[model samples]
Target: MSSAAPVPGRFTFVLHSHLPWLAHHGRWPVGEEWLYQSWAASYLPVAEVLRTLAAEGRTDLLSLGITPVLAAQLDDPHCLSGMHHWLGNWQLRADEAAASGNVALGRHEHRLAAHALADFEQRWRHGGSPVWRELIDGGAIELLGGPLAHPFQPLLDPRLREYQLREGLADAQHRWGHTPAGIWAPECGFTPGMETGYAAAGVTHFMVDGPALRGDTTLGRPVWDSDVVAFGRDLHVSYRVWSPKSGYPGQGAYRDFHHYDHATGLKPSRVTGKNVAGPDKAPYDPELAAAAVRRDVADFVATVRQRLIDEHDRTGRPALVVAAFDTELFGHWWHEGPQWLEQVLRELPKAGITVGTLEGARADGYVGEPVELADSSWGSGKDWRVWAGDQVQDLVTLNAEVVQLALDTLDKLPRGGERDRAADQLLREAVLTVSSDWAFMVSKDSAAGYARDRAHQHAHAVREIAAALGTGSVAKARELAAGWCLADGLFPALDARRLRRCRDEHTSTVPTGHTSAVPS
Candidate 1:
């Protein structure tokens, strides 16, 4: 075979790993189960893939974003125990399916479940910090962090935004001994002038959607004259793997993510045909799916190659192609996803394409001219509608009211003696209330009831604690705050005292005409 010429640009795959705080929350349909499933199906395998690559001496392979709230859950004692149990149960369930005569499905699941169980027992028992830190230390991946609780920063109070981001960076340092210079901004949400806040927080780079850069995504751009850079996701490249209309995961040969064997709690069917009903779909054939993964891997490699060549021809320089997605989209949502990811990574180099992390991209000079980026998100309409839409008006109002109350109450409380559990818990509830997941779920109608209930629960906690303090029921306030802490405890480094009025507050305002406010 002839040796192919080198590809003209670099490629970065970013995976944003996040889930709303779910400890002590209900299970089954939507709660701790969400966490456990993603942990087993996505995190375990994905990290293993990275470890395998690192052993081969690969470095700067990708950018991995783990939000503070998710990190907290991963390292939480309660979550660790729960995950252990979940892995064992998964193995047991697979065995049950085998005993019930679905031999193929049973064997498939059993092998997977057993591997997951052993992986969890040996590597993950201590918690996620060490698992992730290993990758960071190996220089296999760059860790990206976001604000506490993954709140939608654009809709949040400026002071609260600043506080959350600072504490988030500190939390990363506390966990992995390194503060990330880049972030996968929650929801990729941004309002104008947020870059200045990012600069103040010492962030050097962040990601946004393709449209946020007006389709010019060949390189990272400095935002509004700040030293901070904004890397725009290349939709053309990203959508090849997963998009609204078509994607590799939807291929008929791949396992059906939605079709489940209820008794075994395992998916048993393949896509077979898009119109095929669950029961009518063919049984999942690993061999067939593996073949599809190979085909799709070739397709994606070719797609990236052409895109890079086209970009180089246009820009007269080596370009950057970024394809980012939620980490859970791997084994959790697409059974063949991990397989596809591994093959793609291995094949890219042989195919003459270069792979590197976002940090490496910036450091290697893959940056472009400065631009004044406006309000944008990777959400619906490429704006903040998913978080601040009319459909979530009540939630928007609720977040506003609760956050103001929490701030005012914290402001009145004494500052800087020690970490006040009551004040910390109050702020925790407030932060949880504004998580972008709640509104996104509500807008997408994925789990609207659960989303609304969670938002209200956190809002209620904030109100009760503040009211107790106002009524001089100091004991009552502590009790209420302590109770909420049982569930909303994630960021231990958060200091409510620091959230008090700042003499020079970092406002997120960016002058007139730049307001990308959600439609009223």
Candidate 2:
């Protein structure tokens, strides 16, 4: 080790990037538009920031988790063409706004659209794999991955959970040629003994909520005597920028996410006040937002500095503070987020606050004593309620039923024969049915109808294909499965033959834990 003095604490940012499979889905209010918006507003700019920083010799800037489902879309031939068209449409909309006399909004959007188009053409034309590969191979960031469809691990059937986790890791390996050791567990939802499953899948580390650690998030903690560690997000520092009630994005100078100019399809107003109506919002001023970004960056650096000193003083040891957020928060939900991120990454080091990735934190000994973790998530109430609550009980039940049928049908399929397209599609539909997003959206009432519709459609596909296979109508089953695969064909790597109900792999035998009403 170098003879340099240890800093008070280290800080790392974890950005979870994910979206349910949306290829060939409907376009507006909830479907492919979600993918295109995030790709344009978040992925394009975020990749640019990392690329710029990496060119300047930066490494280990942050840990980014791109769920397997989302990765598949980003690289899919269909989605790439869709994104390209989306960019072109964006420029056209800007031109329309200008011709219609909304000059300021038009000028702003035109510049952004032009830049995004250039970036897409230059770096992303082939697919997201190359874009992500450059960052991973260059050591610019640590890529964290999760299950095939971001299922809620706690409620997922053990066999399905194991299959998804293992397949998810393999998906990452296939995409980037490096299997991630860490995962941003879907919903940050976890149950006890999952560490055993994680270990079996070669995952060395994963993330949970702050309260899961009983609020002692000084470092990563090993779970249940295993080498696998769980890192709890330090909510004190994390919430300062991500809290739903108040965060940097909520500042009045920032652009308002809810208000949009219908003609040009652009957000042209600043958050004038917390309770102000959309029409009352003031026109957005980039200069003012830039100032706010600078102020917030300084404030964040100061926050991290104070946190480091306070932690060091309290523990008599250097500390680690992990601030995790959704990657889409940058430039997507918060228009100024990418700028804020760039400034914060640059300012933290200048302020003598160490910035590193989660992988680096683990290797640098930012770990704590072993602790028995429980059922928890970084969601409403910091428990499983967001995914398994009363509002989503139907979805919860549906997921269980679909998973069982898919597993049973796959198990009964003959071994070592031509690949059964029906079986693969059944598993695919089953996995899609259990995606945490459906339940989350339902529970939160964000497009609950859409969530329910999606859940049921997938479940129906599972039931249809399973029935056809059960009745010895092999051709009929394949036909049904082929029809479903037209829409949900993201993971070509998923072969039903590779799946089995292995029950003895996980070493930890602790019973599943219960959830509390603790708020995250």
**Model 1 residue 236 CA deviation in Å:** 0.8
- The residue pairs found clashing in candidate 1 are none
lDDT of each: 0.90, 0.89
For residue 144, what is the lDDT in candidate 2? 99
**Taking the tens digit of each residue's C-alpha lDDT, what string does model 1 give over 1-520?**
5536898889999999999999898897999999999999999999999999999999988999999999999999999999999988988899899899999989999999989999998999999999999999999999999898898888788888888999999999999999999999999988877999999999999999999999999999999979899999999999999998889899999999998899988898999998899999999999999989999999999999999999999999999999999999999898889988998898888888999999999999999999888899999889878887889989988888888788778777765677777888898899999898999999999989999999999999999999998888889999998888877777877778778746147443312353455665
Q: Who wins the TM-score comparison?
A: 1
Over 4 Å off, model 2: 1-6, 501-520
Clashing pairs in 2: none
The CA lDDT at 415 in model 2 is: 74
Predicted candidate 2 versus true structure: per-residue lDDT over 359-395, tens digit per residue: 9999999998999988789898888888877777788
Superposed by TM-score, candidate 1 places the C-alpha of residue 495 at a distance from the truth, in angstroms, of 1.7
